[model samples]
Target: MKRMIAALIVAGALVSLPACGNDDTNTETATRTSNTAESTTVQISSVTSTADLGMIDQAKLAAFVVAFRTAYADLSQDRDDESIQEIVFSSCNAIADGATEQEVTKEIRDLAANDGTEATQSQAEQIYKLVTPACP
Candidate 1:
């Protein structure tokens, strides 16, 4: 189901990218893309295979997770610029601490690939709360 949803989301992004040139429509596209990514299931257990993932840095990992959640929240709330900016800002600490966006994205996709859609989303909300306690 997650794969199906993700596929749908990618399709939406693809559809929106060239379909409209207006900023308002682009914003909607961005929101749609952001929502799709946020709704996409992620697994945090990518660190289990040390050889595959290398030595996991917990702080960087945390930063990525928090950034991931913040992006979703910002987009869903209709704050387009903030949504886009926060993703970069929120993940900066992790990136500086040695986390690459590719690494984080790969980990998330790996986790998403392994879990049930509903369960993964539920877990994501829980993880979001844990990572950004002050937000809620």
Candidate 2:
């Protein structure tokens, strides 16, 4: 009777051990699935018209230009005006690629408006100067 009881206890522990491990694996899988779902939901707005692109406010445009300049600075070694233009145009072209004509027009206009003011241009230039070294 004593031997039988000991064997039953050992058997119970073995069965419970697998349950604990399975619970951990299930938790890990659930976490991974949630993260993947969140990542896939990341949305990039699709522009439908040139007017919609042009409608971007000045503040937004400024931010976009600053972002563009920063991106350009990182991508180029020579930060001349020509280089800046090349980078900017290339970036615009990329945004337009596979996009509708309206979308391309809107993107260009928005970019142009972003640095329309001297203050914004200066800010964009500053960002460009800061990030130029790290560009690919």
lDDT of 2 by residue, 55-90 (tens): 222222223334444443343333344333333443
Candidate 1 CA-lDDT value = 0.38
Tens-digit lDDT string for candidate 1 (1-136)? 3443454455445544545778888788778766654443122123122222222333333343334434344222433333322333333334445766554343333332322322244443433333332221
Badly placed stretches (over 4 Å) of model 2 are 1-54, 74-136
Which candidate wins on TM-score?
Answer: 1
Candidate 1 matches the true fold with a TM-score of 0.23
Residue 90, model 1, lDDT: 37
Ten-residue segment with the worst summed lDDT in candidate 1?
A: 41-50
